[model samples]
Target: MARSIKNPKKAKRKNKESKKKGEASSSSSSVPSMPAKVWQPGVDKLEEDEELQCDPSAYNSLHAFHIGWPCLSFDIVRDQLGLIRTEFPHTVYCVAGTQAENASWNYIGMYKLSKISGKRRELVPNKSNGNESEADSDGSSSDEDEDAQDDAQPPVLQLRKVSHQGCVNRIRSMPQSPHICASWADTGHVQVWDFSSHLNALAEMDAEVNTGATNSFSMDPIIKFGGHKDEGFAIDWSPLVPGRLLSGDCKNSIHLWEPLSSGTWKVDATPFLGHKLSVEDLQWSPTEADVFASCSADGTIAIWDTRLQRTPAASIEAHKADVNVISWNRLASCMIASGSDDGTFSIHDLRLLKGDSRVAHFEYHKQPITSVEWSPHETSTLAVSSADNQLTIWDLSLERDEEEEAEFRARLKEQANAPEDLPPQLLFVHQGQKDLKELHWHAQIPGMLLSTAADGFNVLMPSNIENTLPSENP
Candidate 1:
């Protein structure tokens, strides 16, 4: 899908409706079309139109977050209650490139995420905050959250912008780390920052020094991991091992970084050269600390064992075009999914230590596959995103009949173009936005999905998926 200048892409989704071509698309005659929303620009503010925009009963989705500049990447932020709110959570971090009128440097903004009638909203600073009335309590100022009056215009919350030296390509929120996130840029570097301490002091610092405008939180990098001569793009923080970082660059140089007690990251002396071309994506094995996988523009995905750094334990030329992304099944460590520019995704079973490796392959995409993520909650369920702006939820639970499998092998033996196919396991396919950049399963919620796209961000949930889970209401 072509990315829009008005908005960029990042999203996650799954649906209970079966999308097997025979199943009908959900009828939306009663559903109202989503309307475009505008941000007030700076911090802690949302436009107050009397009519509420949220209508999940009809739309099955909610519009959320409006960073003024178009964003390329984003990661979720946890609220103070530790709940995952797809709609205006406590905070969200996004990386966006410079606009025509802006400077050359790219920008990163930390915005307050919130919700109204289940609709997600980003509260940017209001340009008209000067005349806005904020309720005062006693001699002390009222809490910012409490002072957001309902009758008049809403008060601005907070918006902080930081400029980067290069175009920001990716951002990954560290697993289990409330404050730490890694941001990679075209400058061939990955920066890790812990902003938890900075946030609490921000308001106090604002009071201490009367800055006319909101200053971007000036948090320094806790650890700077660099060494790639080429622009670095692929990065993954090991969820199995704390503080172990992996980043691969355009030239296929992969470096390992480990955080040391001295408050710095130690970069390995030699780079792991596992691919002949740029590494497109890296994913840490969900079950193993010593194993990780890298997909590359060289049209292969290499499984690297950190213990044996000499070379990858296994490799496969899995596609006709560059392999753009990879994901490991969280429930089944032996299963791995890799997507390619050839518009196909192949699932491999690494447990098969010897013969014909691929277990299944899907080739329905007509454009480059941008991202793939295995659902944290379900076994054999995976999400695939395409440059064609499609999100397909695939359940790889289909088992093959022995006779049918043999027939396909016989055909492959007889004809050069013979095909091997897996049984239909498509659960749902959704279309929205101009470009689909990322698909992520909400770590805490089983049917909830967060998606980023060229037009805007969407928080979606499958209406039917609710029946399969233990409902909060029930």
Candidate 2:
């Protein structure tokens, strides 16, 4: 035992000397310059052994993903979501992050999941077949890396990281063209990327390296629009418009962008200058492809006609304070919801806005509602996120009882001690996050929704609700 201990000390000294020699030799050789960005972005954080608090029972979805981006401020992004397309038979999310204090080095990370638990056998792919079912136009996962597959340990199975430039404010995967996505940044630029190109190039590079051919990962943007004069914070790709994209900047200017026939994106010369203050958010109308709405810090929501840049079709004072978020009902052509800084949300019906546009007022939130979205699968279902760590999924299908409402109002008029009845519209109330920053309804998945905040992210589509499809009655 004594000899073993002494030998370890001697071995440590000799190892230190050999490591010094190795460093010297490496310095002398024609070493490749360190790449501008580290290739592995989220590997360290993803491999960090932490107990995942999200219970699988709360989510029936198979492909839900969690992206942990360590950003300094909460200025990551807001009001944008397109369901992530997985490179494998799983749900995937890519988050662009930087080191906690080092804002210059940004990382875009992807986490792929696999399951090994006995209970989750049905949820995960059956690997006994020995064939994977995922290959993308961008070549994200290819046959070249077949040997790289490892035994699953549950939860997360794979992770990849790529670096990016500028402070990315928002990223929205396009629905019509899944390969193309839009990214807006603080540098007043709207950039588009074809992930297929980036991922295909990466796969090809890996194949070359495996065959003893050396190369590097070079990611380039497919298109960039820099017409905004100030911070380009908001971007919304039209669900109805095939390739039309709408963007808003902090300088109260809105620019419409489209792909030209010449294979280039062009910004409209006549920018919409309707709002007097900074544009807070933008949402394309659900029913009309050519019509959309923009909420502003000036406490107004302006409806615009895309064909004419002359003036707004309608400008309604939707809030007493700055309107932070706006969402159109997927099923209702005239219903729109707006959340404001005054800790209230209003459901406005354009058909009934002749005098007062506010239809139903909700003050359940103690903080400003930062994000609001209407469910695509269920009619009259609205989800809103208050920074006060609450995500309320409300069902607006409740019918009011005339007698109950009249009696409650009479009790209020008499100042009698009567408890106000809980609105029947209240559905699921999710809480416990530090700050519920953003919420979105998945464009494709029925009843599915996603929310992210300081605590983490939540993906849920309540199964035990009256989720009758709108198509059933339509």
Candidate 3:
């Protein structure tokens, strides 16, 4: 019997239904569409009238933070209660930037959560009191001084300066220290900053103080690694090793760096090259520190074992257009997910090699997949964002019948033994946005994900849910 052709219409309908069921189960039975708000210039607050333009059922909960255009950088800090630090969780920090000016770019003001209002507001320090300005010879405050001191007390919670004047694309916390690795586009430099000291320096830098006179303020980067003639697009520090770092550039090269005994860092090896076009994204394996993955504009994902010299240990010709992102499964090191400009996402298993040494592949999306991220906490859950302005989450652990699992295993085994073509499982698709550019999963939250687009809106969504909102034009 001849094999049946995969019907695109039938597949799409099934996916739509599956998404609806998933959303209905997770959220309250009712689903309502959220209306879009008009954009007004210089609006510093999210008003009640301007609720999220997407569906409430689409996201788990809304956490609003005002930001600038081209929001190129973000970080997630987990609280002791195991919740991702959104505004309601005491404090949150958000950094955003724009590339409007050449050579000189503006680092917008940093904002923090207000203790009184319970919303994000621009950070400003309280004024000092005149009576408390001078201390008595006995080192005790007078009655008048005591009264002023209370007024001059610092804000219960404040958003202080973290860094300034640099185009930071990504920030990765150090495994050992309280330091973080920050990659910059303008300087082509990667540096480590002590968070405590960095924040203090940022406050002084933004303070209204005289620059010509000597002041008790100094800000210095602890360690700086130099390379990359072009802009650095993506950077990653080894999850296992503290100081070892890997960065990819617009020049289509990956450079490795390590700290040296002389108190400085040096390039440990020659640049590794495999992709024909610019390298867009790179990530180190969660399980193995020496192993890493890189995706490029050449439309390929290459897995590299740093110990290998000439070429990648394994390669997947997965996408038809530029491969924008690739993420490794935290639970299964052998499994990988990738997104491409051709409007498709693919899941690959490195163990399933064909006769020609190609890896196994499964297709997921019909629009340019701009971003893909695997959940850090869950092994089988993955998230993807696309140019079609949709963010979809996949639950690979969903209960599957024995026959289905066996068929999938048989297909994988056949690819390992002999090359054969196969399609991937159709996961849920959250379609609502327009021109999506980035996708990120909250590090601490298992099901929460963030998706941003060129339309100046960054959305948060719950995994395994459907967005019931109507689509808007880009």
Per TM-score, the best of the predicted structures is: 1
Please give, for residues 124-190, the per-residue lDDT of candidate 3 as tens digits.
3234466653222212322333234223322222333333345666555544442344445556766
Q: Write the per-residue lDDT of candidate 2 for residues 1-474, one digit (tens) a residue.
A: 000000000000111222232242111224432211111111212223221122222223323334445431221112123333222323323333232234445544433323312111122332433353222211232222211222323244343455556566666666576556677766677877666554333333422121211222347667877778887556787878667888888888988888777655788867788898888788888678889899888999999998775579889988889898888776777888999988789999888656788889898777888888887667677888886666777867666565645643453332122224445566555544566677676543345566666645555544223324344213
Query: Which candidate has the highest lDDT of all?
Result: 1
Model 1 accuracy (lDDT, Cα):
0.60
lDDT of 1 at 217: 39
What TM-score does candidate 3 reach?
0.61
Task: List candidate 1 segments past 4 Å from native.
Answer: 1-59, 78-105, 116-158, 198-215, 398-423, 466-474
In the range 341-446, model 1's lDDT, one tens digit per residue, is 9889999888774665688888877788888887766776788878877777776774545564464344333212212332346555555555777778766545
The TM-score between candidate 2 and the true structure equals 0.66
Per-prediction TM-score, please? 0.68, 0.66, 0.61
**RMSD per model, one decimal:** 15.6, 18.3, 17.8
What's the TM for model 1?
Answer: 0.68
The ten-residue window of minimal lDDT in model 2 covers: 3-12
Query: Candidate 3: which stretches are off by over 4 Å?
Result: 1-53, 78-103, 108-169, 175-178, 198-220, 224-226, 260-264, 354-367, 398-435, 454-474
Off by over 4 Å in 2: 1-66, 70-100, 110-154, 157-160, 197-218, 400-421, 466-474
lDDT (C-alpha, whole model) for all candidates: 0.60, 0.56, 0.52
